[model samples]
Structures are given as structure tokens and as C-alpha cells.
Target: MNKDQVKGRIEEAKGKMKEVAGKVSGDKKLEREGKIQNISGKVQAGIGDLKEDIKDAI
Candidate 1:
């Protein structure tokens, strides 16, 4: 719902695409980068979720 959440989800999707592309193209570097990006996105999304929870609890 927030900017972070939206951006993170978008990033996650992009990373997934990159991962798939990397696998198909046989690029280990690209695949690793994608995995990192995906993890980063998940973290960002988690942060957003935490913020939302805190706000709701207030």
C-alpha cells in the first residue's frame, strides 16, 4: 500500500524475471544478482509491512 511496499513488490517481480532470464541464458552472475535483488525487495517489503503494523497499533 505504501511506496516502499509497491516499489518492493515491483522490484521483486523484476528480480524474478531477471532470474528466469538468467537461467535461460546460463548467466550465473545475473542469476546471483537477481537472487540478491529479490532478497532486498523482500526486506524492503517487510520493512513497509512493519511500519504499517506499527501505525495501525498506534
Candidate 2:
């Protein structure tokens, strides 16, 4: 995958960890941040997939 995809995956994983940690520690802010990070990662990954699709079509 391209850089965006790779980075997005990493961010998604990190976000998951953060969310779990926050839940264990009772920190709503961290949990919210994690949710945001996960969303951003998904968006980035979608962009990467689109890029690949376009390349293949061409």
C-alpha cells in the first residue's frame, strides 16, 4: 500500500489502543481523541484505496 494507507493503518491501531487505555483509566478526553484518530485513519485509508482504483482504471 501507499504511504497514506500505511500511515492510516498505524494511526488506526494506535487509536484503538488509546481508546482502550482511556476506557480503563476513565478518561473521556482520551477516548474522544482516539475516536477522532480512528476516523481520520479510516478517511486516509479510503483515500489510498481510491488512488489505487484510479491508477488501475487508467
For this target, which candidate reaches the highest lDDT against the unseen true structure?
Answer: 2
Q: Write the per-residue lDDT of candidate 2 for residues 7-53, one digit (tens) a residue.
A: 88888988988899899999999999998998899899889988988
Cα error of candidate 1 at position 14, Å: 0.8
Cα-based lDDT for every prediction: 0.88, 0.89
Model 1 C-alpha lDDT versus the unseen true structure: 0.88
Task: Give the Cα RMSD of candidate 1.
Answer: 0.6
Give lDDT tens digits, candidate 1, residues 1-58.
7888988888898888888889999999999889888988998898889889998999
Collision count of model 2: 0
Clashing pairs in 1: none
Q: What's the residue-level lDDT of 58 in candidate 2? A: 100
